[model samples]
Target chain A: MARAIPTRRRWLLSLLAWAVGLIIFFPILWTVLTSFKTEGEAIAAPPHILFFHWTLENYAEVQQRSNYIEHVTNSVVIALGSTLLALLIGVPAAWAAAFAPTRRTKDLLMWMLSTKMMPPVGVLVPIYLLFRDWGLLDTLTGLTVLMMLVNLPIVVWMLYTYFREIPADILEAARMDGARLFNEIVHVLAPMAAPGIASTMLLNIILAWNEAFWTLNLTAAKAAPLSAFIASYSSPEGLFWAKLSAASTMAIAPILILGWFSQRQLVRGLTFGAVK
Target chain B: MATLHTRSLARLMMAPSVAMLFLWMAVPLGMTLYFSFIRYNLLIPGPRSFVGFSNYYYFVTDPAFVAALVNTLVIIGGTLLITVIGGILLALLLDQPIFGQGIVRLLVISPFFVLPTVAALVWKNMMMNPVYGVFAQIARSLGLAPLDWFASVPLLSITLIVAWQWLPFATLILLTALQSLSEEQREAAEMDGARRFSIFFYIILPHLARAITVVILIETIFLLTVFAEILVTTNGGPGVATTNIAFLVYAQALLQFDVAGASAGGIIAVILANIVAVFLMRMIGRNLEA
Candidate 1:
């Protein structure tokens, strides 16, 4: 490490890293691989590490038994619905705080974040009561609203961080070019901020998709997303590992792909830009 | 040209979010506080008279309260211990110039994306199922009796699952911090004949302290609320053996339908979270000023 000019040491380090990485990743890999194995093979004594007779029966059976598509659609509606709504609210607030240097802006941002700090359980009783009274319990609309508010602070904070980085000169020139406020935001501001907005959206979707507390407590069969989908399998009666594996694999696949692209945003968004 | 007008316009832009967040925060929280001081259980259906601090007193004095509080600490403490120490070691390994590092990073961070319920269920059924789980199979293959994970060491089992989910987060953040260390700093240390341990303790460890703190605080915020994992695996099993304060409050509110008592516990969780929030706010607030 001090002076890296040796091939042998480099090879050894790579092997060690790969070995550890594989260990850290084995559970996920095993889940995915098991999705293709039969129930017996899945729980085989030696445990088929990969050489099982691969089949799509588990996937088909998972869909047949659980209506996987409905769960998938619910997840999309809740995750994207909440994320887009958060953006609808978050983007302008971020813009206002970023472009305007009001003395209270920092306080405003901090206060928004403090809303996030209020643990879900703290308000669970009230929210649950309210939802029950309003007939909003176990509805996609209800979950969307809850998820939006749950992640609203993060959405605002992440968007603000992105918006603050947009150079002022472009907006200035657009204004000088006789662009009205509406046109300025539509043409000039939107394109420049689009990447940041997109990043914030992706991150929020990831958060909303993986949000377990509200998703679990609030929804039942109809409105439950993938979080609840997998939780539904927690107490399965018998010989369901293959199906559980298949369902888990499908539930995480979309978000996992999305998550792969949002690593940088994750660090920034969660940290509230603390590290950077 | 029109500063006051634009400032008001800016205020208008931020108004909806702030108002909604305010309403979202104020209504339920205020409701929780109000219920905390009153006698309100869905099942009991009575005059709903004010109970004063009795709700709080009963809740704190409940035998489950102590166990839950201790378990909460164990989850946070255990997860933090695993993630931070494991994270530092992993970060060091990852920070090296290695082949297929990008693939390795992906493999490492994949767990962070798995929903808690899914992760817990998968771990419980597939890996820790004592009867057919991989861990059991491995233990049996070694001629050792399979340990029933949930029946024994339930908290540690949940802690391991939580740690597995969060280890990637710790690794990624710590690795980000580690990469920021300048090579010149290390080379200079080497020039001074500092050994690998000296370089690590002196050069790397000091640089990573802030990141480690960030990891700890952020993880603590989430870990204190570890509900789904516990729910999916043990259901706070073997008689409140794995129940943390969150699940305890949840059981009180939902299972027992004791709204006032659960509200009291909820308020305590809020207070506990707020104490942590104060620190996080100060730290981030300082960063914002800079």
Candidate 2:
């Protein structure tokens, strides 16, 4: 049933596709380009499209003005820490639900997902007060725990979907071959599920890295991640467009690269496997 | 295939996630419910007295609440409309065999990964600045005055930023769905002399129904709480023009230090979100059964 497309039609379609793509990508492209320009050039009358004196001065200034390294460290720790915690809690839960089904399994999974639907604002007061009472505000540990809780359901859901894809017969065969429970898991199941686990980790890190609500609310100085750090630029400080763009670009670059690599898994994780 | 021994092991394995999720859901929700019924303000540390429904009453009666409610609806509706329609068109275009398709796809999907604060700031300063922004430059080149986006139309501006962030998500999911459409089905319809519009309406649209619903439902949940975008850009400014329920609650609780009033607003937001959550849960529940 497959047919080759005509050359002219394909070329026309390509032109249209590229045009739309460029327009959609223009904002980010503009930001990256502006990051290399001077403050004056960034806000020039006719915005410099391509021809501009590029310099690393903005990047240097952004770093000199703020503790960029501290924020990046916080972002890394929170994203990776929360992702690891979620995986630790999520893997076992997903393995159980995927490998051993009960009447309540479906209901339990749905309930977990419904928790995600509960808007964070609904619980903001209690959590904020609790954090205050316990002196947990502006601490990396507090944020890590919160992010883990926020992303736990998605982690479990994605892992469950991935684990279900692995045939039960293979596990049965391992069991029949006199493999012990730990050996079967460590030797067979882990290897089979490695790709799924990797993608889930990638997606969770990206999510936690970019999570704004809690990070913005709970963090002030000591534990602020890049999200909050970049938000501090909202109050303009004397023609700092280039510096802001530089900070913004640095904050988002790592996650953006990871996101591109895991585009397929993103649909699966966010949608709870509804689309895929 | 599940034996009793296996089921017991499974229960043991599922305990940690289940227990934590239960506590996470129940504890704060119960506290919010309790707080909504009392007179509690962080600023005044007097003995909190039980006030039945007064908190909710005052919160609902506030003029800002009405404005926030309307802004929330508008932002959600506007973002959903733009993302879904634009997603469909983009998906259709990308479905065509094109040159450098990989690079094009990468370009289109990049915005979804941009952090909200970064996206909002980039839009506010670099693109929407009334004086020297690209939009201003374009308008002036054509002999027109540039509009101050946040000052004039704050909610719509926030909606545009949120939509740009989400459009990539919708397009990617819908395109995945579109790619899964069977080639034989399309060829059969074509062999029957179906026009392009007819094929789209009769075949493609129905196939994309589930993906579209998923996009709408997920987007709605996120859009209802459009916080950081407004926070970084407008801070719900220009006379509360862009304050959604989430931002209003935040202002009440954090900025104004009125805990009880904010808790009441929080409860209202929960109920509104649950209305949408019910339908989405049903759809996903049905999918699970299938």
Candidate 3:
């Protein structure tokens, strides 16, 4: 433990931190606040810091004009679906790299990571053509597969880091107890690695939810996610501040709530492999 | 026999994922390379003849290509510069024993988790509007004219907004790194009559070198392809001033339907990305080795 700082200095530092943090967070807060205002109040001169009349008209319009429920359903299906799919494939790969090391494991991991480094646009033309030709355009299956591959490397990386932390002696004991390979993984590894896997799944869902590029380009109307729904609010005919805020709030509310609850897990998972 | 069987089974279990990802990465990239070598514009339909390096030659020679490359570097470099320096300051500030630290941390990190589209919309509409924007309000209060950020210094403003969203990411990572530093090391330096600045320079900074690298690496990976933020804010304009390579590629491919040109640009972008990736891989590789 370190020595305690003086009370005055501590108070000053804490206040400064809070101020900076809040300022950075102000835009999102403003968006949420603006969602409740009428369109006139939203763009009022001097920026209406809580003096305006509140209304749910924007939300009503958003729900009515845009099939909000369908988009929400699409977001849930795609985000969770892709995360589940990624984990299904990533777990075995991570398990092998963690417990059954080979000379090629490091190279394999690096190669997978390198694929992530490749700009998504570098292959956009080909992918667009492939999807178009395959008749997979504007389909959840198309976006689902894209998100899975994009998130696969990250899922595997996190799982590998977590799996490495498990003691080999424990697994060796399981084997010595005459547990079969399938049974050992199912009975031992899965339970032990549940927290890590859960965090991985959560992080993947967030990533897939926020992914805008492919969703915007690949799906127009049929399979567009909430990201696309928010983007639709953007128009050349002046800023629709209230309606756009409403749409944004609806789009991000679920994941933002999830993030708020799981902040610690997310922070832990993000920093897990970075330190050691 | 069981041990051998288990090892083989584990290897086989991993094969499907490895194989699929390989195909997923290679097929599109390989086709991009092929398209880059031929006259394959989407508009012109015919037996595409092999035009060795012609598309690449045209892409390089074009003024827009040069401008796009410069803009890409500007955006990435500018954002990195602000985020790295600002993030370190914020991280250090937040690392202090702060009251309401959890709430502060959440607030700082909230931007990173916001969907890019939403972030862009909020910044463009709420914060930067010359008429009703918060920035304009403050400017008017100071008796100054409202500056239309999108019209004047459009690229710079977009870069600032994007940097704001990403700064929290850098700050959080660095804060975690800072928190892990040994307090005894700082106390020992203070005991030796080292100034706060000197202690930070000598003891704290060295510990943060790896974190900074990670922040830079991850930030660069996304910054190179910053599409939605640019698209929503400026749409690469006041006359192609803010158009980055990614947006350029999108325009070429989808908007203009110049597949040959987009393919060439895509190849160029991939090469540029790989250069940064190599540096990041080496750093991560060293860390993994240690």
TM-score of each: 0.98, 0.98, 0.97
lDDT values, one for every candidate = 0.90, 0.93, 0.86
Give, for candidate 1 chain A, the lowest lDDT window spanning 10 residues: A1-10
- Residue pairs with backbone atoms closer than 3 Å in model 3 (clashes): none
2 versus 3: better lDDT goes to? 2
Q: Model 2: runs farther than 4 Å from truth? A: none
Report the Cα lDDT for candidate 3. Answer: 0.86
Error of 1 at A70 (Å): 0.7
* DockQ agreement of candidate 3 with the native complex: 0.69
Q: In what order do the candidates fall by TM-score, top score first?
A: 2, 1, 3
Per residue, candidate 2 scores C-alpha lDDT tens digits across B1-290 of 88788899889989999999989889999999999999899889998899999999999999999999999999999999999999999999988888898889999999999999999999998888899888888999999999898788777888999999999999999999999999999999999999999999999999999999999999999888889999999899888998999999999999999999999999999999999999999988888878
lDDT of 1 by residue, A69-98 (tens): 998999999989999899888877887788
Candidates sorted on DockQ, descending = 2, 1, 3
Positional deviation of residue B151's Cα in model 3 after best superposition, in angstroms: 0.5
- Residue-by-residue lDDT tens digits, candidate 1, B84-198: 9999999999888889999999999999999999899889888998888988988988999999988888999999999999999999999989988989998899899999998
Error of 3 at B250 (Å): 0.9
Worst 10 residues of 2 chain B by lDDT: B149-158
Question: Which scores greater on DockQ, model 1 or model 3?
Answer: 1
Model 1, CA-based lDDT: 0.90
Which candidate comes out best when scored by DockQ?
A: 2
- Please identify which of the two predictions, 1 or 3, would achieve the higher TM-score against the true structure: 1
Q: Is candidate 1 or candidate 3 better by lDDT?
A: 1
